[model samples]
Target: MEGVIDGDTRALLSEDGALDWCVTEFVRVVDARLPPRVFLRHCPELATAGSAGPITPSATPVTLQLLGSDPRGLAANAEQAISQGVTRLDLNFGCPAKTVNRHDGGASLLRTPERVYTVVGAVAEVSQRHGVSVNAKLRLGFDDKQLALACAQAAEAGGAEELVVHARTRREGYRPPAHWEWIARIRAGVRVPVVANGDIWSLEDYWKARTLSGCRDVMLGRGMLADPWLARRIRHWLETGGERLSPTPWSARSDMLIRYADAKRDAGMAEKVIVSLLKQWLNIMRGRDSEAAARFTALRRETALAPFVAGLSDLGSSSDSTSSGTAAHASSTLAG
Candidate 1:
C-alpha cells in the first residue's frame, strides 16, 4: 500500500464520500528527521490542505503513517509532519515484509511489546502538544498471537487513541482466513477503541468482522482496491436497512482505470510506467471480481499502455485506479 495508495489514489477512492478517512503510505523513518518533501511526496494532499490539515478532495481526513523503529527520530519527524499540516498520525507495526522486519521495523517490533510502547510514546509526546491524536496499526504478532494483547495494550498505554488490528501474524503474510476472531480478543483487552482490519472484502465480511471483534469501526485496505465502491456499498446497506446495491460492472471499473491513466498522462508520467501501474491495480481487482479475473487474464502480459487501457473496456464489468513500483514499499500492506 505504500506505493499503491498514494495521494491520487486516496482522492479517487474517497471521492465517493463514503469513507470516514484515508491513510497515506508509510513514510520510512530511520535515525534522523526527514525533510518536508518526504512527507509531501507520500501525501501530496498536504500541499493544498485546509485548516484541518491534509484531506482528500471529498474532505475525508488523511492520516500520515510512519514506519520506523527509532523513537526520537520518529518524534522529530512527527513534529515535522505537524508543521507541514498533518493533523493525524499512525504508527505501522503490521507490515510483514522481511526486509522491513530485518531492518528492525514493522511487525518485527511486535516480538517485544515494550518496544511498541517506547516508539509510540515518543510520537504521542510530540503530537499531544498540537492537540493531535496518535493511532497505531498492528498485526497479531511477529510469529504468533501470544503477544497480540500485550502489543495492543502497549500502544494504548503509550497514548494511542485508537488501535487497528490486522488479524494475522507476520508469518501468515496475506493468506486468507484473516482470524477476525483474534481481533475480538485484542479489542476486549485494550482500553482505547480498536478498529477491525484485514480481509473484510464485502458486506458479509464486514458484518462478520464487526460481530466477531465487537468493534464499531473497520479499516479497509486491499478490499477497497478490489472494489472501489465497497465503502459506498457498505454505507448504503447500513443506511437503507440491508438494501444491496447492484454488483459493480466491469465497465465502471475500466472507466475508473482509464481516468487514472488520463490523470497520470496529464502529469507527464511515462506511458510504460502507466502500463505497469494499471496492471498492479488490475491484479488486486482480479482477486474479488470474476469479470476482473477474466480481464486480468486477458491483459496479464500486455505491456503497451494503449492495449492495457483498451482491454479494461470489456463488455462484462464496470468501474475505476494507479501504483508506483518500490518493491519494499509495494509490499507494505497496511490494515489488510
Candidate 2:
C-alpha cells in the first residue's frame, strides 16, 4: 500500500471511517544506520499529518514494518523505530516481490525456520526492552505447508506477540480459492494470537474464515483494497446483523479525490505521482460495476489525475443508485 495507501490516501479513508490500523510500507533494513526522519516519513501515521486533526491528532499509530534477513540489523532498526515513537513492529515474511526474495527479505525467510527464529528473537528482545509489541505476517510456506507449522511455532518460541498466517503457499498468487482451513492448523499449533489472512473479502467471508480458522481476528489485504469499506462492514455486521454500511456518495468521492490531490500537492509529489495514485485507486474502485471497470480501464490509459478522478466522479454518481457501495457478499475474489 506504499504508493497507494500513503498519508493522503489513508487520510481519505479515515475521513470515511474505513480504515482502523494502517502499516507503513516495509522500509527494507539493509544496514544498521537508519536516519530518524526516515522513520517519521515512512511511519507518517504517527506524525501530525497522518492524524485526524490538522497537526495535533496523529493519523493512526503507524507500525514501522521492516523486511530483511539479518537479525542484528533488524534489531538495530527496531530500536531506532521505537525511539522515534513507533507504536508497533512488523516483520515481513509474506512479500513476494522478486527483488525481496532474491535478497532473502520476504518469503525467502520461510524457507528457514532457524533464520526466522533468530530474526524474531533479536526483534522480540528489542520489542520487550522497549515495551512495544512485535508481530509477524507470514505465508504458509515457500512451497509447502509442512514447514509452515514449524515456521509458525519457531516465531512463537522467538517471542512474537502475534502472527497473521496467510493461508496460501508462495506459489499461489491472487488466484482463486484460498486454503482457509490451514489457518485452523496454525492456530492450533501456536500459543500467540493468530490472525487469519487471505481470501476474506466480505462479512460472510469473515464468518466462514473464522469458522475454518477457529480464530476471530483477521488481517485483510487485497479485499480491503478492492472494497475500502470492508473492515468497517465486518465490524458493523459483527455488532449487528444483515445491516450493511452504504458506500461513500458520489459527492463524497469527488471530495475525497480532491482532498487526496491537495495532500499529495503539499507532500511535493510529482505530477506523475498523482496520476499513478489515482490510477491505482480507479483499479480498486473498479470492484463496483461494469461501468466502473470501463472507466478504470480508461483512466489507466491516461497520464493525468484530474481527468481520471473526474471520470471516476461521473461513474460513481451514476452507480450509487444501482451498485452496492460496500460488499454484498463475503468472498475473497481479490485474494492473492
Candidate 3:
C-alpha cells in the first residue's frame, strides 16, 4: 500500500492536484520488549515513501500509526518510534477487527475508560518527554453512549493532544445516518482538538459533519479508501465550499492496477497476496462497473495476479469511469 499510495496511485490521484495528510497502516505493537529496528521496519516511511525509485509525493504526507493495548508497552514503543524520527504517534483505539478487539486493542478499549486513561496517559507522557505529539482514535463505546464521553474525558485527562471519534458505537457498525450528532457532543465535551470521523463518504457529509461538530479537523479513513480524492475534496470544500470530485478514470484505474501489481511484485509479495490486495480495492471499484464487479468475482476464483491484472485491464479498456458510484465504493472491501 505504501508503494501504491506513494507511487502510481498518488500520481493518478494528484492529477487534479488535491489531498492532504495521510496515515500509514497500523504498525502493530506486538511485543512489549521488541527492538527499535522492528518499529523502524513498520514505519520505514519515517524517511519517505516510494524510496525504491520514481518517488511520487505521498498522497498525504503520512503519519506512522501504532496499535496496542498496554500503556507501558505502548509508551516504550512510542519512545523508540520518536527516537527513530516518527513525527506523530496515533494510538489506535477505534479499529473494529475481531482479532484486534479480541486482544483488547482497538474498540475493545471503549469497554474500559480506566484502561484508556492509563494507555493515553503513558503515551502522552512519553510523547511530551520526547517533544513529540500524541493523538487518540476511538469509537463511541462497545455497546452504547454510556462510555463514549467517559472515554474522551479519559483521553483528554491523560494528555491527548487530539481525539478522533468515530460516531457509532462499536456495535452500531456502519449504517445510514452516521450519528454525526454524537460527534458534536463529544466535541463540546472535550477541550482538545476533536476530529469528526465515521460516515463521512461525501462532500455533503463532510460539510454537515464540520457544521455539526464545529471542529475543523476531521478524519477520513474508509471515505478516502473508497475515493482517494475524498480528502482533497473535503479540503477544497473547507476552503472554497464546493469542489467537484469525479471518480478515477478507467484508463487511470487500469494504469494504477498495473502499477500496484508491479509494486506488490517488487515488494516480494506472493502472487496470491498481490491478487488478494487487488481484490480488496476492487470491492469498492466494482460498484462503478458491472463488468468490474463480475471480473472481481471471477478473479477471486483464480490463483494468480497475472490473470487478475489481465482481467482488470480488459474491463477498464471497455468501460468509462463515472462519478456517481456509491459514497462507500472506494472502501467497501478494505477495512481501514
**Which candidate leads the pack in lDDT?**
1
Q: Please write out the lDDT profile of model 2 over residues 18-89, one tens digit for every residue.
A: 444555678889767588877777656555432231221223344567899899999999898877677578
TM-score of decoy 3: 0.83
TM-score for all models, in order of appearance = 0.93, 0.87, 0.83
Query: Candidate 3: worst 10 consecutive residues by lDDT?
Result: 326-335
Q: Across residues 1-336, which tens digit of lDDT does each residue of candidate 1 receive?
A: 645687778878777678888888888899898988999999899999878989888787889999999999999999999999999999999999999999999999999999999999999999999998899999999889999999999999999999989989999988988999999999888889889899878878888988998888888998888887778777777776677777776766777788888888888989988888888988899989887888889988988888788888655433322221111101112231
Q: What does candidate 3's lDDT look like per residue over 144-197, in tens digits?
A: 889889999999999888888888887886665677788888888888988878
What's the lDDT of the predicted structure labeled candidate 3?
Answer: 0.68
Residue 299, candidate 2: alpha-carbon lDDT: 72
Scored against the true structure, residue 326 in model 3 reaches a CA lDDT of 24
Clashes of 3: 2
